[model samples]
Target: MVRSILIFVITYALFLISGFLFQIDQSWYDALNKPAWTPAGGTIGMIWSILFACIAASITIIDRKAGGLNNLKPAFWIILIVNYLSNQLFSFFQFSQKNLGLATIDCAIVAISAIILTVFALNIRKIAGILLVPYVLWTSFATFLSFMFYSMNL
Candidate 1:
């Protein structure tokens, strides 16, 4: 139980670090012609926070089932890292660089990675896998949102 808590903390910390490193350019983002369905900035942050909490909880469950982080398959780590990086890249491309095309591509990768993570987790632990459903759904929606941004702005 202690180990699971530790893993959750570490996982969440990494998420925070990624967010800090990929700080959004609010001024540039505000200039974009966003879709009507786009959530407010605060709502976006709240959604991400909820999603990250879900991810951290799911990771803890997986860590417990796998006997430890070290015991998990290499593929799990690879997918997790790829998903995190792809997610960060979406923010970087969309807000920092203001490149909707590249951002859309990054978001697509993120959605794909989320699906991969869910399938891989299911193979490891049923409940752990189930926990990723929300992540997958959210990423799918985000991918659509990114596509809309790209299409509307271009």
Candidate 2:
């Protein structure tokens, strides 16, 4: 139980670090020609918060279902870490570097890695996989948004 809580906190914190480390340039982002369907800032934040929480929960569940963190397969760890790194890179590419094209590609990686992670989680536990659905969906949506941002700005 204690381990699960620790895992949840650690995972969520790691995911949240991108926001802190690569602060978004509001002026630049706001000036972009966004689609009418683009989510407002508050809505985007809320969605991310919820998605992060779900991702943390999914990881925790997978860890438990596999018997323990150490028992998790190396392949799972590789995919999970890759997904996390790709996720963090989005903030750097989109905000810090202001490279929408790179951000769009990174988002696609995040979405694809997330789908792979979900499949791995499903092999361990159904609920764990289910928990990641929103993360997968949101990342896929964000990928589209990133592409739109790139094309519109170009």
lDDT of each: 0.85, 0.94
Off by over 4 Å in 2: none
Instruction: TM-score for candidate 1, please give it.
Output: 0.93
Alpha carbon lDDT at 77, candidate 1: 93
- Candidate 1 achieves a global lDDT of 0.85
Give lDDT tens digits, candidate 1, residues 1-154: 7888888888877776656767777787787778888999899888888888888988998888878879987888999999988987877787677788998999999999999999998998888888889889988998899888888788
Error of 1 at 49 (Å): 0.5
In angstroms, give how far residue 26 of model 2 lies from its true place. 0.8
User: Model 1 segments beyond 4 Å from truth?
Assistant: none
The top-ranked prediction according to lDDT is 2
Alpha-carbon TM-score of each model against the true structure: 0.93, 0.98
